[model samples]
Target: MFFALSKVLGFFALPSNLMISIGLVGALALFAGWVRLGGALLVISVLTLAVLGLSPLGNILLLVLEDRFPKPAENDNRPVAGIVVLGGSFDTIVAGARGEVALNESAERLTVIAELAKRYPEARIVFSGGQGTLFYSGATEAQVAARMFESFGIAPERITLEDRSRNTRENAVFSRDLVNPGAGERWLLVTSAYHMPRSVGCFRAAGFPVDAFPVDYRTRGYEDMTRPFRSVGEGLRRVDIAVREWVGLFVYRITGYTDALVPAPL
Candidate 1:
């Protein structure tokens, strides 16, 4: 029930979807002769879209989340018992059809596998992801990741695949159950920079304490805060990503998925 509700509500909650819906509704209202109401809605829709798509607001919002958890220091030599990489780095639909591993914009989540494998030869690796779409598809993200890992020459015994989890919370819960790391052992969580806060919160809430290994940063740094996007599509995409994450963070906290509103490094 929670998964279904989250998916449905999440669709409408996206800034792009909301703005597009408003524009469509306004068009329909104008067609029905609701002049004043239609004009107001249309004006609001256009202005909101312009602000989201042309301004630096998205970068500013993303920076707040991305900067919440920094990448582990270069000199912090720590023993990692295991590593967990969340899904959403692959395009399961394309991969399933083509029989080839296809990565999306979040490919860094998977590309980092090679570096990690070299760094921690002894650490067990867990890849957690399942079909997240409302409609059932034969493809699973974990399967695609498995192929990629094999191509990377990672040892089979060192890798564990948890393919049933469809969201971040389940990724943490299922990965923890699958590995059951020893107390005080360190585990590294690899995911996108903007997603680290919620990802960390979920793992912490599930009693799995893992250090953040953030990758796939969308923003350069504080400098991006003042820069406007040249392409409206690019800006809108960033805004959608940032807004969705912020909404997810709030929803997760209020729903008791995690005690922290914004999980910080220990």
Candidate 2:
């Protein structure tokens, strides 16, 4: 129930979608001869879209979340017990249809596994992801990632696919139940940099302590604060991603899915 409601509300929560919705309603109002209300809404919609698209607002918003958990420094030789890669990296529908691995913008989340696998040859590799789309269902992310991992030369024996997780909370809970990490075992949690805070919070709440291995960074650094996107679509997409993460963090915290409102490195 919560999942369905969140999915529905999440659509309107995106600034791009919300602005378009306002514009549509405004057009309908104008057709009905409600000039004052219609004009106000239309102006609001256009102005909001312009600000979100042309300005550096999207980059600025994303930088906050991207900078929350800095990617762990390299050269650490600590023994790793496992590596857990969260979902949202692959285009499962396309992969299923095309008979190949089709990765999205978050491909780094999965691609980094190749490097990690070589670095920690004995570490257990776990891919947690199920069917995330509300209507479409075909090959799961884990199924697609399996093909990719095999292409990366990772042994099938070392891979564990938890294909039931549909969200970050589920990823944490399901992966923990599957791995059952020992007290001293070190595990790395891999996901997009902008999503690390919420992912870490969920893992922590699930009693799973894993070091953050943030990948698929959307921003360079603080310098990106003033940098604007080249296109409206690109800018709006960035804003949507950043806003969704912020909203997810808030909702997860309030719902007790995570204890931290903004999870930090531990």
Candidate 3:
């Protein structure tokens, strides 16, 4: 139920979608003779879009989430018992239709996992993700990930696909049960940088102790705020991603799905 509701709410929560909705309301008001109210709402929606797409607000908002968890040091040689890579990296629908693995903006999550697999040859690799879309019955993210992993030369026996989870909470619970790590075993959680906070919190709440391995960074740094908007579409998209992540943290915390609103590295 939460998964379905989250998806529905997420669409309406996007900056672009919200603006369109508000504009539509305004248009309806105008047609009904509420000229003043219609004009006000129209202006508000346009201004909202302008601010989100042209100003530094979107970049700053994204930076806050991306900076919440820094990437691990290059030479930190921590022994990883297992590696858990969350989904949202593959275009499962397209992959299923085209018979090819297609990656999305979050492809870094999977790419980083591949590299880590080579470095930590003994570590078990677990891909936790199921069908997250609504009404689209295609290949699961885990199935595509398995094909990708094999193409990268990762042994079939080394990969464990927890393909039943549809959200981050499920990802943690399902992956933990699938891996069933013994005492003192350390697992590394890999996902987009902006999503690491909630991901880590969920894992901790599920009694799965894993180090954060954030990838797919969207922001360059704080300096990105100084640069002009390269593309209004891209800026608005980033704002949507940031807002969705923030909402996820809030909802997960309130629902007791995570240990913290913003999980910190230990």
User: Is 1 or 3 the stronger prediction by TM-score?
Assistant: 1
Looking at model 3, report the run of 10 residues with the lowest lDDT sum: 226-235
In candidate 3, position 164 carries an lDDT of 96
Show where candidate 2 strays beyond 4 Å.
none
State the C-alpha lDDT per candidate: 0.91, 0.91, 0.89
Using all chains and alpha carbons, the TM-scores for the candidates as numbered come to: 0.98, 0.98, 0.96
Once fitted onto the true fold, the runs of candidate 1 whose alpha carbons sit more than 4 angstroms away are 136-138
lDDT (C-alpha) at residue 153 in model 3 = 96
| 1 versus 3: better lDDT goes to | 1
Candidate 2 TM-score over all chains jointly? 0.98
lDDT of 1 by residue, 99-192 (tens): 9998999999999989998888989989999999776575799999999999999999999999999999999899989999899999999999
Residue 173 of model 2, lDDT score: 99
Expressed as tens digits, the lDDT of each residue in 1-266 for candidate 3 is 86788899989988889997999999999999999999999999988887787777777877887888877799989888999999999888898899888899999999887789999999999999998898687789999999999889999999999999989999999998888988899888899888999999999999999888888888789899876577777778878888888888999999999999898887
Residue 92 miss distance in model 2 (angstroms): 1.4
For residues 185-264, write the lDDT of model 2, one tens digit per residue. 89999999899999999999999999999989888888888887888888888888888888999999999998789998
Model 3 lDDT on a 0 to 1 scale: 0.89
